[model samples]
Target chain A: MVKLTLNVVMAERNISSQELAKAIGITPANLSILKTGKAKAIRFSTLSKICHVLECQPGDILKYVDE
Target chain B: MSKWLKIGINVLIMFLRFGIVAGYFMLIYPIIYLADAFQNHTTHAILNGSDFLRFSNNQQATLGAVKRFPSWPYALIMSVGVVLTVWATIKLLKALIKLLSNIRDQNYFSTSNELALITIIKAQVMMLLGDLLFASGNQLSQSWLLRVNTGVFSETWETCFHDVFQIIMLAAIYETYRHAMRVKAENDLTV
Candidate 1:
């Protein structure tokens, strides 16, 4: 199963959703959704954008946890 | 009016536009076929006998039966539909963008609004992409460079993309609704 753990990273880095949104050229609402793992799928471009802004990797934000 | 009411109106407007387009095509198709048939019949009749009165009457009837003014109503309806759809789409997109921006800027760490905003954005993107694909497919047959295979492939790709996008959008929407329900429950408890 695909699992995302962005919340933990955000907490660890003390990154606000707004900052992440601005940096990634997306709205904070989108960032918030991503943070909560409520998003069904992530655009590769958007994922790249987020990673670029958050100074993280895809693996850092997402993980494959057993369902 | 409420936001949901506005959305309903927008949907009705879209349906009206679709009906108008269908009606236009239905009206024009038989006329085109009849025109071709009449032209062929006239050519054959002229070869046999030059009955000027009958020929003139036929021409007059065809011209009179063409229904010129009906096009105006269709044009007007189509124009209005296009404007309404465009306006609604823009308004929704702007609202989504603004809400997302606000949520991010305000640094609201709560999950509910964030999830809703994300779902909204995904929905907008899917809608935009679907519209684009539809418009592109509509034009594909008109292009000289486009082959039947290419057109078919493009259409298939468009369908696949639209389906996948919709599925993702629906999933996001479900997640948002779940979060909203949870948030509402928490708020009720607090109150």
Candidate 2:
């Protein structure tokens, strides 16, 4: 399973979904879904955008758990 | 600016709306089925053939009395179903249109987005097919074909779609992450 640590990162950074969405140029609803790991896939550009805005690595946002 | 991201957002929104509408439908299905089943039992003597005459006489009278106000609960449920279905359908169509437009505007493309678009289209098609099956009043008890139609399509299509799309999306995401890491590494090197 693919595990996303976005919620923890966001919380640690004090970043709101709306703020992340605004910074990444995505809707807050979309950001919320991604943060919640309901998103089926993410775009590289979107990842780049988010990493740029958050100043975090991809590993900070996502992880893979082999079950 | 990336078409893939826009398409992904649209797909995510559409999926969320679909989930909500589907949840509402599942919630009301039992009520509708029970009501219809009761009406069926009363009108048809198939439930109890031996007691048919006596039950029919009483049920006929009861049904006649019930017919006067028959439209209330069923009508309300049907109306709600129609409204939710229409709302979901509209949202789905809008999302699909936006995705298509994004595809059209793409100069550099992600194969993953194309696959995601196809998956979304297939999902929508399966949804419509399920609706058609239901509208035709075909139940699982009636035919195995009806029972497995959407399931078979969804299983075969969804697995393949998810697998291929996920791989592509993951690769693109990883590539972007790597590029960012490289840039960061270079910046660190310069400093």
Candidate 3:
């Protein structure tokens, strides 16, 4: 399964969830969904925005894991 | 759903409910007459006196014709079945109306809409069971009592098949809606 490591990236960058959510122009609840791996899919544009806001590559926030 | 579409569907549901109530009254009228005449010695005269409704011999009776007087208990049971069938059909229509209203409000996949669909399926099942029980009781009563085939005993297998078909169709719709609800939830959760 594809899992998000957004928390680890945010923690390393000293960014709060609210800061990242607001920076990426998404609601905090939606960011929580991504952070908790509850999201079924992510749009390319949103991913790009998140990557830009977090100053990281897509791979830094996303990881595939065997379930 | 479009505003007009919702309005149209709601209107149709109300119309269907009205028809069910009217048909229920029609079915119950004979029972009411029979009950009223049960105390009188002229039960036969009162039943046969009506120009629009007359019971004839089994030989002269067609599918639409009423033949012979069912026992009072048989008639009562048949009336109960008709009541149940009509009640369930009306409930089913009500559920559909609720579902349509939910769709009109852009509340597709809401729990209330799912419950409404479930209610629709349950009502269809109730209708099927009520009809089948009525049919079976009619047969049993005919065999046990005066052997007079009255009331809905004359209903063909096609009617039973139609009821079963409707139940199956509603079940299919319920399943499809369930699938769609899951898809909608997944879509909603996606970022």
Top of the candidates by TM-score: 3
Give per-residue lDDT, candidate 3, residue B85.
Answer: 75
How well is each residue in B63-160 modelled by candidate 3, as lDDT tens digits? 23233344454556556666677778777777777876776677877888889888987887777766775676455433433233344434334567
Q: What global local distance difference test value does model 1 have?
A: 0.51
TM-score of each: 0.28, 0.28, 0.74
lDDT (Cα, tens digit) per residue for candidate 1, span B79-162: 333343344345445444444444445534445455545655555554445444434433332132122223211233465466
Judged by whole-model lDDT over C-alpha atoms, candidate 3 comes out at: 0.70
Q: Specify the poorest-scoring 10-residue window by lDDT in model 1 chain B.
A: B144-153
> B1-191, model 2: which lDDT tens digit per residue?
67677777667766766765665555554455456555654223212333212322333334444333333333343334344444545545555555555555562244444444554554454444444333332222112111222321122334445545654664566566556655654543320
The segments of candidate 1 whose C-alpha lies over 4 angstroms from its true place after superposition are B1-191
Best by lDDT: 3
Tens digits of per-residue lDDT for model 2, A7-59: 88888899888888888898877777776666767788988888898899999
- Which 10-residue span in candidate 2 chain B carries the lowest summed lDDT? B140-149
Ranking by TM-score: 3, 2, 1
> For model 3 chain B, where is the 10-residue window of minimal lDDT?
B46-55
Residue A24, candidate 2: alpha-carbon lDDT: 88
Give the true-contact fraction for every prediction, in order: 0.00, 0.00, 0.81
Clashing residue pairs in candidate 1 are A18-B104
